[model samples]
Target: MIRFDRVTFTYDGCARPALRDVELTVDEGELCLVAGRTGVGKSTLLGAVNGLVPHFTGGHLQGEVSVDGLATHTLPPQELAHVVGRVGQDPLSGFVTDTVEEELAYTMEQLAIEPKVMRKRVEETLDLLGIADLRHRALRTLSGGQQQRVAIGSVLTAHPRVLVLDEPTSALDPTAAEEVLAAVTRLVHDLGTTVLVAEHRMERVLQYADRLVHVGDDGRVREGSPAALMRDCDVAPPVVRLGRLAGWDPLPLSVRDARRAARALRDRLGDAAPDEPPATGGEAALTARRVRVTYGDTVAVRDVDVVLESGHVTALMGRNGSGKSSLLWALQGSGSRRSGTVSVQGRDPGDVPARVARGLVGLVPQTASDLLYLERVEQECAQADAESGAAPGTCRGLLDALAPGVPADRHPRDLSEGQQLALVLAVQLTSAPGVVLLDEPTRGLDYHAKEAFALLVRRLAAEGRAVVVATHDVEFVARAADRVTVMAEGEVVADGATADIVVSSPAFAPQVAKVLAPGRWLTVEQVDRALAGAAAGEPA
Candidate 1:
C-alpha cells in the first residue's frame, strides 16, 4: 500500500540529508513500527508517505514515493488526506475543533462524507476508542491523553486506508497509551487497515507490530520481523537483553514467551527459597495524608494517601486526570490543595509559603519549558544554583548529569523536545531538594534516551533522595521505580512494588502483561532474562 524507492530527503538549507536513499514498503494491512534515535528522520519518513515532505515541510526530495499507487510528491496534502491519516507527536498542536465529538467528525465532514455516515462513524469511533463519555467535553478541557485519543479518532474517522502516527502516545500515560495502541490494533485486525507508527516506547508496540523498521543515524534502514530485528540489531526491546542471555531464538516478542523462557531458566537454577519479610526503612522523605485538591467545584485529587521514602524510586502511575499532577502540584505548593496534609521532611507543605515551598520541592512539569525562561541552559542552571545557595560548579555538574554530551551554551528552546525535557530535569535536580517530582519525564525521548534516563533515575534514588515520577511508560516504571502507585478518578487505587503492582493490578500493568501473566516485568529484556533463568534444570 505504501512504498519508498531510493528516497533521499533533506531540509531546505541543511547540509545533511535527514533521510538518504531509504527504500521501504508497507503491504496492505501491515502494521509497521518505525524506530530510531531522536532526530534520526523517523518523522520525516512518515511525511514521505502522505506528501508532507517536499510539499508541506519545504525539503529537498529525490527518488520516488508512492501511496496506494499514487505518487506522493505529485499530490498535495488535501489530495492524499482521504488515503492517509497522520497524527503527530504533540497532541496540543493537532487539535482543530473545540469539542471532542466535533473533532472526531470534522475530517469526515470536510471530505463531504454523508452526514449520516459521519454520525455513525463518530459514534462507532467514540465507542471503539472508549471516549463515548467525552463527547460533550471541550478539547482544551481534556487531559493530554484524552486529547490524543480524540486526535487519533478524528483521523481514523476519515476512513483512511493507511494510518501514519508519529509518537502518538508519547504524551500519554501507560493506560492511555495502551488504550490508543489497542484501538490501532483493532483497526488493523478487524478492518484490515494499514498502520505505520513511529514511537520511542518500543515495549508498548513492539510485540504488536507485524514488521520493524529501524532507521539508522547514518540514514540507513533495516526492515524485518520485530523478533528478528530485535535479536540482531543494536536496538531491541528491553526483554531482548534477557533473551540474549537465555539463548532463545528469534527472542520472545511478547511476555508469555518470556515467561516460558523464564520458567525453564529458574528450574535450572534450583529455586524454592523460603519467604522473608521486607526490611525496615527510615522515615519517609515526603508523605501525603488524605490529600485533596480542588479547582472551584471540581475536585482534581480526592482523599489520596501515600508516602515516598528516601532512597526509593516511586512511580506515580495513573490514567490522565487521575489526580497525579494535582497531587504533585499540591505537595509542592505550586497549585492549591483544598484539604490535605502533605509533609516534606517533617514540615507541612500546606503551611509553608509558596516561595519557600519551592526550595523544599523540585518539580519537572509536564510541559518541558514551563519553568524555563532563560536564554542559555548553562546560565539558567547557574542562576538557579545561585538562588538555591548551591555551588555554581555543582549546578553545572547536575546539568551535565541530566544532558550529558550536549553543549550547555545552547539555547534550551533550540534543542529537541527530549533534550529540552532533560535540561528541565537538570535544572530541577540542581536545586538540592530532598524530594523530586517528574511529570512525564520520558515524553518525546527515544528508546536510547529512555534507558539512559532510567539509569540516571536509579542513580538519584541510590543517593538517598526521594524521587517520584508521574508517567505513562510502564516499561520505564518497571525498570527504574522501586514501587508503583495506581490512580483512577482522582483517587489512589493501588500501590506497591513495581513488580507486584503490575503483576497484581490489571489497570496499572502494560499490555505485555496480558500475554505474559504471573510475575510481570516491564521490559522485554527483563522478561527474556527471567525466562532464560526459569528454563534452567528443565528437561529438554
Candidate 2:
C-alpha cells in the first residue's frame, strides 16, 4: 500500500539529508513501526508517506514515494487525503472544530463526503474509540489523552486506505493506549487499512506491529520482523532487554513471552527484594493543602494534600485527563486553583513576582518547545541566563551537560523534538530553583536519550533538588521516580515508594515488572544490578 524507492529528503538549508536513500514498502493492511533515536529520520520518513515531507515541509526530495499506485511526488497532501490519513505529533495543532463530535467530522466535511455518510462514520468512530461519552465536550477542555483519542477518531472516520500516525499514544495512560491500539488493529485486520506509526514508546506498540522499520541516525532504514530486529536493535523495550539478560533462545517481544521463559531467572533471584531508589533526605521544598482545581463544573483536582521533599523525584501517573497536569500546574501556581494553599520554599507562588516565583519553582510544560521562542538555541540560552541573572554561558553550559553537540545557531523549531525538550529543560534550570516540575519529559525521547535524562534526574536528586514529573511513560517513571503518585478523576488515589506503588498496580507498572511478576522488579536496570551483584559475590 505504501512504497519508498531510493528516497532521500533534505530539509531546506541542511547539510545532511534527513532521510538518505530510504527504501521501504508496506503491503496492504500491514502495521509497520518506525523506531530510532531522537532527532533521527523517523519523523521525516513518516512525513513522506502522504507527501507531507516535500509538499508541506519545504524539503528537497530525490526518488519516488508512492502510496497505492499514485506517485506522492506529483500528488499534494490534499490529493492523497483520500488514500492516506495522516495524524501528526500534536493533534491539537490541526484541530479545526471546537468539540469532539465536530472535530471528527471536519476531515470528512473537507473531503466533501455526503452528510449522511459523514454522520454515520463519525458515530461509528465514536463507538470504535469508546469515546461516545465525550462527543459533546469541547476539544480545548479535553485532556491530552482525550485530545489524542479525538484526533485518531477524526482520521479513522475518513476510512482512508493507509493511516499515518506520529506518536499517537504518547499522551495516553496504559488503558487508553490499549484502547486506541486495539481500535487501530481492528482497522488493520477487519478493513485492511495499512498503518505506519512512529512512536518512542516501543513497549506499548511492539506487540501489535506486523513489521519493524528502524531508521538510524545516518538516515538509513532496516526492515524485518519484530523478533529479528529487536535481537540487535540499540533501542528496545524492557522485555527484549530482559530476554537478552536471561539468555532466552529467541528474544521475546511481549510480556507474556518473557514471563513464560523467565521461570529460571525468577528462581535465580529467589525472592530477593528488588532494588529501591536512593533514599531521599532534606526538608520539604513544597507542600500543598487541600488543593482543588476546577474548570466550570468539572473538578480537575480535588482536595489533595501532597508533599515534595528535596533530594527526591516524584512521578505523577494517571489516565489522560486524570488531573495529573492540572495538579502540577496548580502546585506550580501558574494554573488555575479553585481552592488550595501551595507553598514552595515557604512562599506561595501565586503571591510572588514572576521572577521570584521562577526562582522558587521551575516548570517544564508538556510541550517543552512552548518554553522556547528565540531564533537560535544560543540566543534562547543567553536570554535565559539574563532573565535568571546568571553568567552569560550558564544556560549554555547546562544545555551542553544535558544534551551535547546541539548546534548553537540552529533555530529551536529546527531541532528535533527531543533536542528541543533538552533546550527547554536547560532554560528552566537557569534559576536553579529548589523544586522542578516536568510534564511528560520523555514523551519523544528514544531509549538512549531517556538513559541520559534518567541520569540527569538522578544527579538532580542527588544534589538535593525536588523533582515532580507528570508523565505517561511508565518505564521512565520506573527508573527515574523515587516515589509514585497515581491520580484519577482529579484526586490523589495512591502515593508511596516507587516499588510499592508501581509494582502493586498492573496499569502503571513497567515491562520488567509485568514479565517478572510475583516479584517487585520495577526496571531492567534494577534486575541487571542485582544479577551483577550476585555474579560478583561468587568466591574465585
Candidate 3:
C-alpha cells in the first residue's frame, strides 16, 4: 500500500509549493487513477511515491509519504526501486539501455539478479506487452507509443509489487493507447500488481480504475470510485457529457454503457435528423501539389498532393515518423518544399514574404507553447496578435472563444499543459488567417479537454476558416476531421473522408473501429446513426 499524509512540497528555488497538503492512498493490488490537468502535482505525486520528490528534486517536503510500510523520505529512490517500478511521463527520463530487450534486463541486472533469470524476465515482459517483435529494435527507432510501452515493459520485468505510470499514452495513437492499457489491465488482473496511473486521457483509463484520485492545482486530492467522482467533475468524459445531456440514471462511464442510454433517449425524445453535408467547391485555402521535402539524404515527404478547402478541418493521420509533421511544416512554409508547389490562396508559400505568409497561414507547432517567453498569459496573446498584424482586441476575443472564463492574469508558463496549448491556439487563431495548422493539438490533453478541443476545432471549421491538424489522435480525427490523410515514409499514402479511410484501412484504424460494424463508423455519432439505421431496417 502507498499513502500520503498531508504532504506539501516546494521546490528549492520556487516561491510556491508544487503540491500542498496532499493526502492520498493506493491499496495493495488496487488500480488507482491519478488525474488532473498537467503540472497539477500528478508527476510530483508519482515522484513522491518513488522518493524522487524531495530526495532527487531537492525540495522542501512536509508531512509523510510511505510505500509498503516504508517511509519514502527515509529511503533513496535507488533503494526504493526494488518495490516501485515507475514509468515516467517522459519516456527518455527512465531509460538506462539503448535496446528494447536490454533496457528490460537492465533493472534486474542492477538488482544483481542471475543473468538467466533476467533473460527469462525480459522475454516474458516483451511477450506480455506484445512487443516481442520489437525486442531487438533500438530505443531511438521506436515510435513514441512503442517507446512508452518499452519503458513500461522495462520496469514490469522487475516484477515490482507497485507500478506507477505517468501519462503513458500522451504520445500514443488511439490503437496504441489501447494496447498499452490492455497490458496494464493484465498486470493488475493477472499479476495482482498494484497500479497507479497519472494521465489526461481519462476515458482510456476510466474502465480500469478501481478508484479515481483528482488532484487540483492547489494539490488537493479527492479520491473515490471513477463513477461517483467523474460524474460530478466538470471535465469528465464525452459519455458523461452525453449522460448529462440525456438525463440518465447512474451516469455511464464507458461509451458502450452510454450508447444504451442514448438509444433509450432516442426512443423517448426522438433522434435529431442528421445535418446536411457542408457545401463543396469553396476556394482552396491551401494546396500541396506533388510536394516533397528531404532531410539530408532522406526524404521526409514525397509527392504529397492535397488541398485544404476553405472552412474545413483536415486531419493528417499516420503513425510516428510518417511525415505528418513534415507535411504540416510544408503547408505553413516553415520547412523546405523541394520538387513541388505549396500555395496559400494561389500565392506560392516559398516565394511569398514572411509577413504576407503570416496573414495567409498560422501554425501552432507541436510543443509550440515552449516558444512562449512571456510572463503573463494575456500579454503573451496580445503580443503575438500585435506582431502578427492582427487588429487590437482580437487576442482577447480568441481567448474568450477558447476558454471563456479563464483568468488572463495567470502566468502562461504556470498554466497546465492543456491550458498552455489552448493559449497558443488563441494566439495563432486571433489573426484569422486563411488557414490554421495544428500539429498534435490534442497530444497531451485529457479526455475532458480533448472533447472540448474537438468542439473548438469544429467551430473554427464551421466559421469557414480552414483548419489542418497533423496528429495521431484517431479519436480526435473521428470527431473533428472532415478528411483524413495517411502518410508513411514521408509520402501521402491515403486520403479520403475520415470515416471511410480510417474504418476501412487496417493499419490506420483506431481500436474502437475493431469493435464497431465497419463501413464508415468513425465517431460516436456515426456509430449511433449506423445503429439507428440498422434498427429502422429490422422487422419490428
Q: With candidate 2 superimposed using the best TM-score fit, by how many Å does residue 13's alpha carbon deviate from the native?
A: 1.0
Q: Per TM-score, what order, best first?
A: 2, 1, 3
Ranked by lDDT, top first: 2, 1, 3
Stretches of candidate 2 exceeding 4 Å from the true structure:
141-143, 278-280, 389-394, 400-404, 538-540
lDDT of 3 by residue, 388-444 (tens): 678877877766555454457777765655667778877877665778888988765
Q: Write model 1 residue lDDT over 194-253, tens digit each, in one string.
A: 999998878778889999999987778889888777866766665666667667776887
**Candidate number of the best lDDT:** 2
Error of 1 at 208 (Å): 1.8
**RMSD, one per candidate, in order:** 4.2, 2.0, 4.8
* Reference-based lDDT, residue 23, model 1: 88
Better of 1 and 2 by TM-score: 2
lDDT tens digits by residue: candidate 2, 1-540: 888999999988788888999888899989999998888878888888888888888978999999999998898898988889988788899899899999999889989999999989988999887789999998988766677778878887878899999988877888878877888888889889999999989999999999999998788999999999998898999899999988997899899888899999988777567768655657999999999999999898999998999999999988888898898888888889998799986799978887788778888898887777899999999999988899899888877766677789889998888789888888887876889998888877888778788888888888999999898889998888999899989888888888888887878889999888768888888888788877777321
Q: TM-score for candidate 1, please give it.
A: 0.85
Pairs that collide in candidate 3 are 200-446
Compare the candidates by TM-score and give the number of the best one.
Answer: 2
Lowest-scoring 10 consecutive residues by lDDT in candidate 3?
A: 268-277
